[model samples]
Target: MGWIYLILAGCFEVVGVTGMNKVIKNKNVQAYMILFTGFIFSFGFLSLAMRTLPLGLSYAVWTGIGTVGGTIVGMLYYGDSKDWRRILFIAMIVIAVMGLKLTSS
Candidate 1:
């Protein structure tokens, strides 16, 4: 349950990131709503996740998910570079995240 909430928090973090970009580009009421709503839910779920997950482990995983998810979203929707090197680094982050999860109890 904690892990699940953590994952959800990470997912919302991506939404927040997206909203940030939208706000920067457009700066409308809808953009503000997305940004605030996304971050609010993200923090809410993160706090819920902390009930069972260790602080360090949960934080690392949450940020990892956000990093990876945000990068993918940028590449797919926002025209970020899809360079091989960038992808390789992203893959490395994924591997390190997996390693952390494996090490955690």
Candidate 2:
């Protein structure tokens, strides 16, 4: 349950970041609203997940998910650089996040 909440938090983090990008590019009020809501829900879920997960482990995973998800979002939707090196690094982050999850008790 805690892990579920953490995963949801990470997803919301991606939403917030993507919203930020949209707001910056187009100055859309709806994008700003999404950014605000996403952050609020992200933090709220993260706090709930902390009830069972270790602080360090939970934080690392949450940020890892956000980093990877945001990078993909940028590439797919925002036309970010799609260099091989960037993709490789994103893959590395995914591996590390999985490793952390597998090792956690």
Candidate 3:
């Protein structure tokens, strides 16, 4: 259940970041709304998860997942670079996040 919150937090972070990009370009009103709502939900869920989760571990997992998620969102939604090296690094981030979660769990 806590892990579910963390994953949802990551998804919300991705939505927030991608919507922020669109909002910055003044290209999407809906994305702006999504951005605002996503941040609210992400933080809310993270706060809830923190109730039972260790601060250091939760923060690390949250940040790592969010970073990878944001990068993928950037690439898919904004046509950002998608080179092999970048993908590999993102995969590493996922692995690290998973390792941390597993170790901490």
Name the best candidate (by TM-score): 1
lDDT per residue for candidate 1 within 1-105, as digits (tens), equals 998999999999999999999999999999999999989999999999999989998899899999999999999999999999999999998999899889988
Candidate 2 on 24-96: residue-level lDDT in tens? 8888889999899889999999999999999998999999999999999989987899999999999999999
Show pairs that collide, candidate 3: none
Q: Can you rank all candidates by TM-score, best first?
A: 1, 2, 3
Greater-TM-score candidate between 1 and 3: 1
TM-score of each: 0.96, 0.95, 0.91
- lDDT for model 2: 0.94
Report the C-alpha lDDT of model 3 over 1-105, residue by residue, as the tens digit.
787887788778877887787788886779779889989988988888888888888888888878998898788877889999999999998898878877885
Q: What is the alpha-carbon lDDT of model 1 when measured against the actual structure?
A: 0.94
C-alpha displacement of 55 in model 3, angstroms? 0.9
What's the TM for model 1?
A: 0.96
